[model samples]
Target: MTEALLDEAGLVRWGRSLGEVAAREAVFVALSGPLGAGKTRLTQAACAGAGVSEAVTSPTYTLVHWYTGGRGPVAHADLYRIRDASELPGLGWEELETRPGAVFVEWAERAGDELPPDRWEIRFEFAAGGALRRVRVCVRGCAPPIPDPAVYSAAPEAPSC
Candidate 1:
C-alpha cells in the first residue's frame, strides 16, 4: 500500500491505522527512511493508537525501548547507530520477535537479515516541497487486514495496492 502524507498529522493518522492492524501477535514493522523523514513520530503515534499512554521518544541513543502499557508489548528499536547486523543479537532481536507482540524497527535496513521474514515494510520519501511525504507499505508473509480508511479523517491518500 502507498499513500501521500500531507503533513505530520496525516502521518500520525496513518500510523494509527497501522497500529490497529498491528494489535496482533508477533507482528514486525520495518521503517526505512532518511533523517527527518518522520519515522520516530509515526512510531510514537502508532504506540498511542495501541493504547500506550507513556511518552514515546526515539531510542536512537539507547537503541531500544519497550512499551508494555499498550494492548500488548511493543518493542521499538533504532538501528541507525549500529554498524552491522551482528549487533542485533546482543540487542535481544530474537526475543523481540518471539515475545508475542509488535516490534517496530527504525533504519531497518541496517539490520540486514537479522529481521524476521514476516514483516511490514514502510519506506518514506520526501515529496515535492519537503513539506509532504510519500509512504509505501508492503507486507511480507502473512499480515492482518488493514483498518478501514473511513475510521480516520486525516488518513493519507488511499493505499495504492
Candidate 2:
C-alpha cells in the first residue's frame, strides 16, 4: 500500500497501525529511505503502539536496540555503517530473528540476502518540498496483512504505550 504523510503525526499514526498488525506474530520490516526521512520516527511510533514505553532511537551506532515493554520484544537495527552482510552474524542477526517479536531494519538494503524473505518493505520519499512524504509499503513472501489506512486515520483511538 502507498500513502501520503502530511505530517509527523500522520506518519506516527501509520506506524501505529502497522505495529498493531505486527503484535500478532514475529515479523520483519525493512525501511528504505534517504537521510532524515523519518525512519527512526516511524519505528519509535510503532514501538509505542506496541506498548513499549522505552525511548526508541536510531541504532546507527550500536547497530541494534531491543525493547520489551510491548506484547513481545521489538528489535530495531540500523545497517548504515555495515560494510558487508558478513558482519550481520557478528551483530547477532540470526538470534534476533529467532525471538518472538517484531524487527524493524533501517537501511535494510545493506543487509542484502541476510534479511528474511518474509518481510514488509517500506520505502519513503520526500514530497512537497520536504513538507510531506510518500510512503510505499509492500510485503514479501508470507507476511502479515497491513492494516487499512482507516485504522491509522482514527488516530485518537490508536493504542498507546
Candidate 3:
C-alpha cells in the first residue's frame, strides 16, 4: 500500500499515469470515498489518459457507462445508488468484470465481497482543511503497482474538489 497528499492537479496527474500503465492490460480499479472526494474526477482524468476523446461523466444515476478509447474499452460504474451487492448482477456486473482494458467503479465498497479478488483499491480522504486529498492505493492478489503521486512535482492549483 502507498499514500500521498495531493492537490487537485496532482491527483489528476497521478490518475492519468495510472491509466497509462493500466491501459496496457485489463484491470479493475475500485474507488472508495465520501461524497466530493474526487472519485469521478480521477476517473475522468484516467479516461483521458487512456485516450478517451468523449466526456467522462459519473454514472451516479445511469449506473454504468462505456466508451472506446485508443487503448481499448473503458467502463465506468457508480454504485452509489445500489442498495446491496446482490443488486449488481441486474446491472450486468458479470459482463463488466470481463470487460477488457480498464474498469473503474465508484463507491465500490458498496459491492462488498462481490468485487473481484484481483483488483486495485483506492481510497480518498479530505485533508489539509479539505484543501487537498489524502489518497491511498492498495493492491489485492496480482494487481499491478500504482503510481505514487508524490513523485510528481507540484502542479498548478485546480478547481476545488
Candidate 4:
C-alpha cells in the first residue's frame, strides 16, 4: 500500500508517475472517493503521462471515454451514475477490461464484485479542512507494481488535467 497527503498539484505529479508506469503495460485502476476528491483530475493526469494529447474529461454523462496515447489506448470510465454492477455491461465494461493500455475507472465502488481481481485500487479523501487530499493506493491480487506517491516530484509547470 502507498499513501500520501497531497495538494492538488502534488496529486497530479503522483498520478503522472503512476501513468508513466502503466503506459508500459496494461493495468486497471479502480478509483473510489467522494465528489470533488480529485478522481477525475488524477485520471486526466495519468492520461497525459501516457502521452494522450487530447483533452481528458470526466465521462460523467457518457460513462466512458476512449483515447489513443503514444503507448496504446486509454479508457476512462465513471460509474457514479450506475446503481449496480449489472449496468456495467451496458457501458461495455467487458471491452474496457480488455483494453491494451491503462484503464481508469472513477466511482469504482459502484462496480462492486464486477471489478477485475488483479488491479490497482485508489481511494481519495479530503483532508486538512479540505485544502489537501489524502490518497491511498493498494494492489489487489497479483497486480503489477504501482509507482510510489511519496517519491513524486512536481515539474516546473503547473499541472492541470
Reference-based TM-score of each model:
0.86, 0.87, 0.91, 0.91
Worst 10 residues of 2 by lDDT: 149-158
Instruction: Tell me how far the alpha carbon of residue 102 in candidate 2 is from the true structure, in angstroms, after superposition.
Output: 0.2
Better of 1 and 2 by lDDT: 2
lDDT of 3 by residue, 69-100 (tens): 78877889999999779888878677777667
Total clashes for model 3: 0
The best candidate by lDDT is: 4
Evaluate all candidate structures by whole-model CA lDDT and list the values in order.
0.77, 0.80, 0.85, 0.85
Candidate 4: stretches off by over 4 Å: 153-161
User: lDDT tens string, model 2, 1-161?
Assistant: 64544467788888887776776567899999999898898899889877889888888888889888457678899988887798888786786677778998999998898889998999888877886667778889999876654434322454677
Looking at model 4, which ten-residue stretch has the lowest summed lDDT? Answer: 150-159
Prediction-by-prediction clash tally: 0, 0, 0, 0
| Candidates sorted on lDDT, descending | 4, 3, 2, 1
The residue ranges of model 3 lying beyond 4 angstroms of the native Cα positions read 153-161
lDDT by residue (1-161, candidate 4, tens digit) is 87878888888988887777777777889999999999999999999888899999889998889989886678999998999898877687888876577889999999999888989999998888897888899999888998877665322335576
Candidate 3: clashing pairs of residues: none
Candidate with more favorable, higher lDDT: 1 or 4: 4
